[model samples]
Target chain A: MTYLLLFLAFLRVGFFSFGGGLAALPLIEREIVDTYRWLSKPEFLELLALSQLTPGPIAINAATFTGFKVGGMLGAFVATGAFCLPSVLLTLLVVTFLSRFRENPYVAGFLRGLRPALLALLLRVALSVIQDGIHDWFGLLLSITGGALLFFGKIEEIPLLLLGGILGLLWYGWR
Target chain B: MPERHRHTFLLFLTFLKIGAFTWGGGYAMIPLIRRELVEKQKVLSEDAFLEALSIAQSLPGALAVNTASLVGLMIGGVTLQLAFVLATALPSFFSIVVLAFFFLRFRELPLIQAFFRGALAVVVSVIVLAVWQIGRKAAEDSVDLVLTVVLLGFLLVTGIHPLFVVLLGGGLGLFLRR
Candidate 1:
């Protein structure tokens, strides 16, 4: 029963999480944190950061991690499989039947409409992450400087995360 | 190994390597896919890859997973698609499980908490930048701008589930002909 719920929950995440990994944040937060109470908000944010810091897709990471927490190794596999199932099924559907789907005007219109709304969703998430994630002056400074660097330069994500980790150790470890 | 089996195994290995090595997420895998599949192995032409990317983008689910599935389907069919999905997802599945194990165990440690805080701070910045970059391309016109604001207000003010909000957005789009 627990496994089934996990499957259903993540399946919803897979089907509804359009756009990509970042766009999936609010939905994931809803199902996993608010709906299921599987992970707290702080833990969810940590999962998000960890997913970004590591390799592969964020959705997959979230599924596996949360699944492991809820049910164990088997749960992890179940959740992860549920998350990937949509892409596999949808990919097959598009390839076999709807090759011209993207070129369709109505489809284009729907996507164009979906785009800005998605932007709004993403913006709301960004604001909340900032609100929940930043607690100290150092954190604010780090966010501002890091965001500036990312916007201005070609800097990659891992290195910045690594630098942040080191700065954290220096600042918080001693104190 | 038989020739066919070897070929399938090699294809699986290619995706496994791509999955394990690439950081950031699905978008990050594109260059590697282009390099390995398009340029190196000659699995598919550039145009085909682009088309696959478009199709992948159009679909729901992870962009990386969707693209990999399409490429796999193009190369071999359902068999390769299944294999590709497994290969692509396995690395992160294993990596995160291990991380989660350690994270749960040592999460209360001061050092871990500090690192978590620090890392999360940077993640906040990354997300802010993503909003900026994606927001620019997302709003194509004044109508879109208004829609964004309206949707955001609904999301923030109302207690409506985001799933419903997403549906409402799509429903509005179909009618608006945006």
Candidate 2:
């Protein structure tokens, strides 16, 4: 029953979590943390940390972590599997339908129309994540520095991540 | 292996590689997929890839996984598409599981905590970059700019579920473009 609930929980994440993993957070928070109580908010934040460090999509990683905590190894596998299952099926369906109706107004309209709204949705995600992470003055300054370096400075990503980890170690570890 | 089997195998391998290397998420994976599938593999041209990307971006789910599903369907059929999805999901699936196993056990170590705190900050910056890139392109002209602001206000104020926000956007899209 737990596994079934886990599958269904992640199924909703797969079906409706547009944009990406960050965008999926609010919904996942609502479903798993609030509704099911599978994990506490603090535990969820830890999973968020894990999701970021681990490669691949954030949503999938979170699912695996929660699944493991709730139902053990099998729960982890089932939750991760169930998370992606819907999207895979839906992707195929949409691709097939779109190809055959490439010129259809509705399809074209949907694409043309979704732009502004999607932008806002993504913005909401960006703002939310930034709001969550930047707590102290140093954290705020770090994010500003990170954002500036990434966008304006044109620094490469790997080194930036390394520098960030070092800064965090020096900052948090020392304090 | 049969020719079909070989193609499917190669497709799976290609996605496996993409899934393994990508750090930021679906949007970050887009360029990598473009390089391999469009530039090298020549399974899809740049234009077709972009078009599929457009559709994939709007749809719910991970864009990388969705894009793979689209590409796999075009190259082969349902079976090939599903194979690609599984291949794509597998690397992240297994890697996260392994990492979580270790992370949970050793999380209390000061070094681990420091590293995560730092790594996570950078990770968020990567996300900010992704959002900025899209916002630049998406927020063209006054209509788009206004819609973005209005919707931002609406979501933040109303506290509506994002699922509904997205669906409402779909409807708004039809009207805005008209």
Candidate 3:
């Protein structure tokens, strides 16, 4: 039953996760955190941090870790397998009839429209994260500094994550 | 060794290297895809690579995984396609399992909690940046801009399922075509 739920939850994540990357985050959060209550919000954020810090795709990392935490090794494999299943099937379908979808305007139009909705979804998720993570003056300051470093200074994300950890240790650990 | 065996072995090794090495995931693997698949292996022509990329982008699921699957299919067949997916995902799978084991174990420590608080703040910043990046591309014109605003508001107000949002976006897009 647990394995089935893991598969179903991640399968939904895989199917609706168009444009990939961070765009898929909102849906993953919905299914895992909201629907199943598998991982709490803070835990989800921590998962996000780990996913960013680690190698490989964020979706795959999320699936593997969530499954492992929720079930076990087999659960991890099952969830990851479920997540990849849609992409395999869909890609095969697309490859087999490559010519038909090559210049399909309907597909293009749908994708174009998808971008805005995806942006909205991402924004909603961001807002919630801000609400959850930024609870005090230091939290606010950290986010601002992190934002500036990421956008203006053009530093990479992994370094920023590390820097944040060290700063947190100093700021919160001591106090 | 037989030619087919050699081809399969090369395919497996190339994808494994890609999955294991690339950091930051998703589109981060594109350069390696170009380097190994196109430049070194000479399996896919530049045009074919781009085609696979576009298709991967269009379809749902992880861009990295989709691209790997397409490339695998192009080179071999369904068997290679499945093999490539496993090869691409295995490294991350094993690493994350190990990491999760540790993370969950030490999650209650105050020091670790402090570290996560800070790290999560950065994670929030990353998501905001993602929103900004996608926003620029998504809101291409007045109609798209309105669609974004309206859909954002709708999501905020109703808290409807994201699947519906995607379907609604695609449907509206078909009719709202300029």
How big is the positional error of residue B14 in model 2, measured in Å on the Cα after superposition? 2.8
TM-score of chain B of each: 0.95, 0.81, 0.95
Pick out the ten consecutive residues of candidate 1 chain A with the lowest summed lDDT.
A108-117
Better of 2 and 3 by TM-score: 3
Report DockQ per prediction, comma-separated. 0.78, 0.57, 0.78
Clashing pairs in 3: none
Scanning candidate 1 chain B in windows of ten residues, the lowest lDDT window is B159-168
User: Which parts of model 2 are misplaced by more than 4 Å?
Assistant: A20-22, A37-49, A100-102, B38-51
Query: Where does candidate 3 stray beyond 4 Å?
Result: none
Residue-wise lDDT of candidate 1 within B73-99, one digit each (tens)?
Answer: 998899999998899899999999999
Return the TM-score for candidate 1, rounded to 2 decimals: 0.97
Q: After aligning candidate 2 to the native by TM-score, how far in Å is the CA of B51 from where it should be?
A: 4.5
Off by over 4 Å in 1: none
For residues A1-175, what per-residue lDDT tens digits would candidate 2 score against the true structure?
Answer: 9999999988888887766565677677767877899987545655766665556777877788888878878999898888788777777777766555536666556656556766777777667667666667776677778888888867766677778778888989986
